[model samples]
Target: MTTLDLDFVRSHFSAFNEPSLAGWSFFENAGGSYACNQVIDRLTNYYRKTKLQPFHPFPASEQAGREMDAAINNLAAYLNVDEDEIDLGPSTSQNTYVLAQAFLSIMQAGDEVIVTNQDHEANSGAWRRLTDRGIIVREWRVDPETGYLDIAKLDKLLNDKTRLVTFPHCSNIMAHVNPVAEISAKAHAVGAKVVVDGVSYAGHGFPDVDALGADVYLFSLYKTYGPHQGLMVVRKDTREALGSQGHFFNEGLVHKRLVPAGPDHAQVAASSGVTEYFDAVHAHHFGPQADASKRGPDIHDLFQAHEQVLMAPLLEYIRSRNDVRLLGPENPEERAPTISMITNRDGRSVAEDLSKHGIMAAGGHFYSHRLFQGLNLDPEAGALRVSFVHYTSPADIQKLLKAMDAVL
Candidate 1:
């Protein structure tokens, strides 16, 4: 069986070599990943040479536009979606806010949008605000004890008036991977649009949005080892149905329809670096394939295989502790490598304590505060989240475990 080359992977990120980051084992990757060298180089180059308005007639502008176009082209290919379906904006929160307006244009007063307690506030808050416009918002609550969202509950919520069904691909705190394809199918059958917040899951492995059948799939690139931007896949039909949330003249433009916030050209251009990193990884593990959709799934599998290897022992060690309660699945294969534990002490305090031992992690609501309430826990108490990605090494995990033991 092939295993991820950790040394080879870590070399692609310059953060590993930084004197400031030396001796610190990062475990708060769900918050944001350290940008890869590919992305950094692209950003620096863009700022130095082509830091001008894009899509214009001038050379620098043309080059800037080309980089942005290549970014969309490359990323869309990797996500298994068409170029026009991709929308790059400031952040996932802003992107979804604009998208809710699109939905508002299409939705009637009595239409219902299903949300989940497990989603980050970025995905939850905007849609919930639709209540002010008379749109019915339904919540798919998680189990108070386990923080698990049952699909059976969602089945009852799906009906003719269900205009949209919004949920997370995986919770930031819980780390469980929701069945996006299955949920999409159910929503589609009811003539409802599926909006998946893939913010947590995309960091682990970008999904096949085309196959997943989500009308709007949202995730933060910053969390996925790229620039600080939100990437979304808005299906053609959904875009047309909701119409333009941008200027009236831009209604005909596929990319501009929902992106009223416009785009940061440099960051958008840097996105290609993420795809390039994935390409390099794919070619290293398995010979190069021309089709990026093929590369998308292949790279996804490679990432997951490596993550499961890292997650197994960490999960076991957490579950063994009687004092702390682990959220989400008990098995490594069933969830992303984000482990959130509710201990007797405040999670933030635990994180602060871990930091003293050179373990970089976080504790707090993590913008998923609603989840704490749903799980019958106090939001102020928060949950200790120790997350990692492909770039993390076994040595880092060992350091985290030792620090965590000392802190807790």
Candidate 2:
């Protein structure tokens, strides 16, 4: 098995080399990650030289269109989905809002839609609003003590009337990686379509959308070391089931149907850089002979192995503290690198104190207010979140532990 080359991985991201951010360690990666040099360079070149309307006869326009198309096709290959299924929107929140609207037009008044307490507002709020149109919205609540969504409970939620089921691949606050395939299977048994929010999970590694068995899968590129854009994959059958949200004339185009806000040409084109970065990492560690589809799991395993090692000490420390309540699983294999804790101290104040030691972290509800309320946590003060990615070093984790000791 090939391990991820940390030296080779760190070299792709420009943030590691910045003078101002030199000594300071970043742990707020769940909010957003530093962009890789490949993405930045592509974005700069697109704005400087190819700042023209795409798909035109001119040189700049043709090149711009090619880059954008390549991004969709390349990413689709990595995720093992069709190119037509990929939709790039402004943000994940915006994407779900549009999807909900499409569902609204097609769904009947008695139709049931299920939402979870564990999802970010991006996936929850939109579907919940369908209640206004006489749709029956059911809540798939989480365990207050552990913040885990019990799969057994979902069996009761799904019925003949259930039209859709939306949940997260992993919660931002809880950090427990949900079993998408298992949940999707249960939903499918009841003839319900599944929508998975992968925004929290994608940074670990892009999951195979086909394998996950979700009708609609979403993730944010900004959190995945690219530009601020949301990438959505809607299965062809599901897309055809929903009403088109785009213009009447453009209704025939499946890709443009849901994203009526229109595409950002430069950012979409720059997304190709994300694929390029993954390829570079794969080629450096393993051989360059593997196809894009084959490389996805290899790169995914490499990052997952490295992240689990980093998560163990942090989990052990948090779980041992009498004053703190650690959210999600203690085992690193069962979760991502996002660790949140409820402490006797104020979340904001603890974050401020950590900053003095040059550690970057955050404290807030993270837009999962329903989750906090369900767990009997105060939404006003929220919980302290320390998140990181494969780029984070062991030295950084040591610094975080030391800073946390001083604050607590």
* Candidate RMSDs in order: 1.0, 0.9
TM-score of candidate 2 relative to the true fold: 0.99
Q: Please estimate how well model 2 matches the true structure, expressed as its whole-model Cα lDDT.
A: 0.92
* Cα lDDT tens digits for candidate 2, 141-227: 999888999998999888999999999999999989999999999999999999999999999998989999999999999999999
* Residue 183 accuracy (lDDT) in model 2: 96
Cα lDDT tens digits for candidate 1, 1-408: 668888888889999999999989999899999999999999999999999899899999999999999999999999988898899999999999988988888898999999999989999999999999999999999988878889899999999999999999999989988888999999999999899999999998889889898999999999988999999899888877885878888788787888886789999999999999999988898886999999988889989988888888788888889988998898888899999998999999999999999999888999988999988888998989999998888888888888878987
Candidate 1 worst ten-residue window by lDDT? 236-245
